[model samples]
Every structure is written in C-alpha cells, then in structure tokens.
Target: MSKGKAHAALTIAGSDSGGGAGIQADLKTFSALGVFGTSAITAITAQNTQDVTAVEPISNEVVAAQIKAVLDDIRIHAVKIGMLGSPALIETVAQSLKDFDGPVVLDPVMLSKSGVALLPNDAVEALVSILVPRATVLTPNLPEAAKILGEDEARGDDAVLAQGHKILDLGAKAVVMKGGHAEGETCRDWLVTPEGATHLDAPRIETRNTHGTGCTLSSAIAAELAKGADLEAALTRAHGWLHGAIQAADQIDIGHGHGPVHHFHEVWT
Candidate 1:
C-alpha cells in the first residue's frame, strides 16, 4: 500500500487492440481523471474503427485468477465490468466479485458499432440473472435494456424511463439508461434508481467517432465513484467529460470507420 496512491478503480473487461474500447478505454478514462487504474482482461479483441475481426475469450479459471490477484492485493475503490462473452464467463465474474463491497458499474456491452456481436444469446440470460442483480449501477443502451428485459428496444422518453425502472426491478441499485439510440437532437441519459430519476442531457454531436463511448462513460463513472463521488454526481461529471471528449473526437484521426473519442481532450491540448 503506497502512501500517496491515487484512488483506484478496477476494470474487468476485454482488451481492445485498437485502444478505443474495453480495457484500453477504461484505463484511459481512469488515468485522464487522475484515478489509479487496474484491469482483469476477460477477452482479447482484434478490432479497429472499422471492424472486429476476431475475439478470443480468456479461460474462466484465468479470468477468475486475474480478478483474485487484483482484489487480494490492491486497494480497489470501484469496479467497472464489460464484455463477458459467455455464460460461464459471466458467472465467473459474478462469483469473483461476490465479496467486493464497493460500487460495481456494469456496462452491458452486447455488440460493436460494426454490428459484431460481443455477448452471445445464451450469455445475456446469465448476465441478467447473475450480474445485473449485483450491479451498483447498470449502464445499458436502449437495445441492451430491451435485451435484458426480453422486450423490444425502447425508443421514446416514456418507453426509455419505463425500461429503466424495469431494470432497477432486476435488483440493480440504479441504472443509466443511455439515450444514444433514441431519435432526438439532444442525447438524454437517465440515471434512474428506485428512489427517482435524473438526466444528463447533451446535444448529440454528429460524428462517426463514437466507438468506445459506452465503455468510456462506464469507466469514467467508476473512476469518479472511486474518488468518492455519489452515483448521481459521478454520472453528471462522467457525462460532461464524455460529451467533451466526443466533441473533440474529430481532432484526432486514428481509424477509417468509427474512430475513438479524444480521451485526453482535457490534457492533450
């Protein structure tokens, strides 16, 4: 235990070779926000802005061991989970985090922007049954919310709020119902709990560089939570930061298709 170590948040997710999403995006967001970052990689992905060519999930034993190694030693303050490919892998993560007392930010990553599936059909059940109940805050896009609840994708505000409550009924303490898929000029993401709901609304920027927005936002929330921000405050701050990042995404040109947001937007200028 170092004397002056920063607040630490652990990201248990896949590795994106393109450095846009998953472990790479999570770590980048943590570092950008002055939080110490740690990771337990569940899978390795061969992807770019254009496509996800291949994916190789780490064995369950290895994934569990990675999580154990970090939890046993590091003083973790928060955890963000993403992209567990199978039922066994989801179960492994749930079991590994069973004893963790800090906030768990669960981002239900189902597919890439290029239409490549990340979580399989059967694994979605395990995620809802196992991990969703354990989540401190479940962050799910519109389609993901529908998938979790076995309903059609939510479109308008009323439907979105309705689904958000349904997700809270699944036993998550709260949910961030992302409105990226909704048809509107403003992107409104609801932070819904059993208590009530608030929103972080920003004007939707027209850009093709939204590759890792979900991963980045979830990890940013984790980082803020590690720094002792309450769930509402964390969502507000993370949303503002991500909006800035997305606005500055065009400043950098990395890939051919959907490029990454400028994670270092605050620092690199």
Candidate 2:
C-alpha cells in the first residue's frame, strides 16, 4: 500500500438498514476494491433484501451539507450517485457536482426488486434534465432506461445499443446499459462512448442473493476510476468483480430473503 495517500471514492445515495444495498453496498464495494469510501445519504430506508418497508428522504440542505463537508476536506477521486429520493435531491446533488472534475458514475436507481419505489415519479424529470449531462458515466438497467426515456420497454440485443444511444443523447459522456432484466442465458451490458460501443456478457448466476448488484457494480467502477482507470478498463474490471461477488453470494447467509452478494470475495477467499 502507498505510504500516506489513499484513493477516495464518494457515494451519494440512500442507506439500507439491511446493509445489502444503497450506501452500505457502495461503501463495502469500495473497501473491497481498496478505495477509501465516503457517503452522503439522501434517504434512509428500513429495508431488507426481501422488502423495503419505509423510506424517509433527508432534507436537501442537509444532503448538500454532507457533500460539501466531504468535498471540502477530502480529495475525492471519484463520485458515485445513486437513489436520490426527490426532485430537490436531484437538484442539490447536481449543484454539488457541477464543479467537480473527477469521475462521476450515476446509477439511475428507480425501484427496488421488492417493488418499492426508490426515486419518485417527478424526480425522474429532474434526474434527466439536471444530473444526466453532468455524469461521466451513466448506468441504467433495462426498465430504468425505459422509465427515463418514457418508453414502454427496452429488451433484445438491438435494444441494448438503441437504449444506450438514446440515453447518451440524454447527456452523459458514456452509458452502460445493464442487461440483468433481459431474458436470456447470458446477461449483456453495453458500454457506449462517443467514439463507439463495446459490450460484455456473462452467464447469469441464478440466485436470490442478487440484492445489491447495481449499487455494488457502480461503486466498483467508481473505485477503479479513483485508481485512475480509463472508462473501458474501469467498466471491464468492475463487471468481473461483480460477477465474482455474485457467484460467491451463497458463501454466507446474511438475511432470510434475497440476501446479498459477497462483497469481500477476493479479500477473504
């Protein structure tokens, strides 16, 4: 390890009491990838892997303060944005990052697998108009992409590239469309940059412990970016890391429901 310096990645998102997702998943993934992690919680949820029972959004002022506190003191190398609860949060978060030049991975977390709504309906508009353009990399699953684009659906091999471009037009340096929702033996994620597009595929690991895959993946990408990886390299490495975690998910039984992927698979192996 380096003598005094540490690569830092900040997660601005919600908190999951169950610790399977949200800031919990993000920070855990960061530590697993050897990055110093910080967080500004936008919402607090009484949630387990199976269900999200309650949600309370923090005040926009406080969210701004938490981000400022970290930015003022720490030299954050990357920032991962996730699960902003409202339009106010979307606006404030964008304002906070408007000046930051570091890598920013925005995960458009719209719903919980248990059918809980993470981002409010109105906030979707703000996310598109405000945060999308500022993001260094935008990550959205199939359903989330449809919601943001006001489309009914996005599936199929061609839908991946089409959806990625439509999202790229929404304003991001690049887009990574996650394929977990699509039906197939293989899950494909496409990375679309201005120059071109590249895709990665992996056999889907069937399990209920897929609770926090999105948050973990985005946070891992931010961690790699904090370590100065290029966009393609960061996504490739992050994808492989998430695959390992998911494959090793059953190694522990944390909760009774969907459970969580093993974030420290590499560390404690």
Estimate, for each residue in 165-209, the C-alpha lDDT of model 2 and write its tens digit: 988898899999999888988999999988999999999998889
lDDT of 1 at 103: 96
Give, for candidate 1, the lowest lDDT window spanning 10 residues: 1-10
Give each model a TM-score. 0.98, 0.98
Candidate No. with top lDDT: 1
The residue-level lDDT of candidate 1 at 172 comes to: 93
Q: Which stretches of candidate 2 lie over 4 Å from their true place?
A: none
* Model 2: colliding residue pairs: none
lDDT of each: 0.95, 0.92
User: RMSD of each candidate?
Assistant: 1.5, 0.9
lDDT of 1 by residue, 212-267 (tens): 99999999999999999999999999999999999999999888999999999999
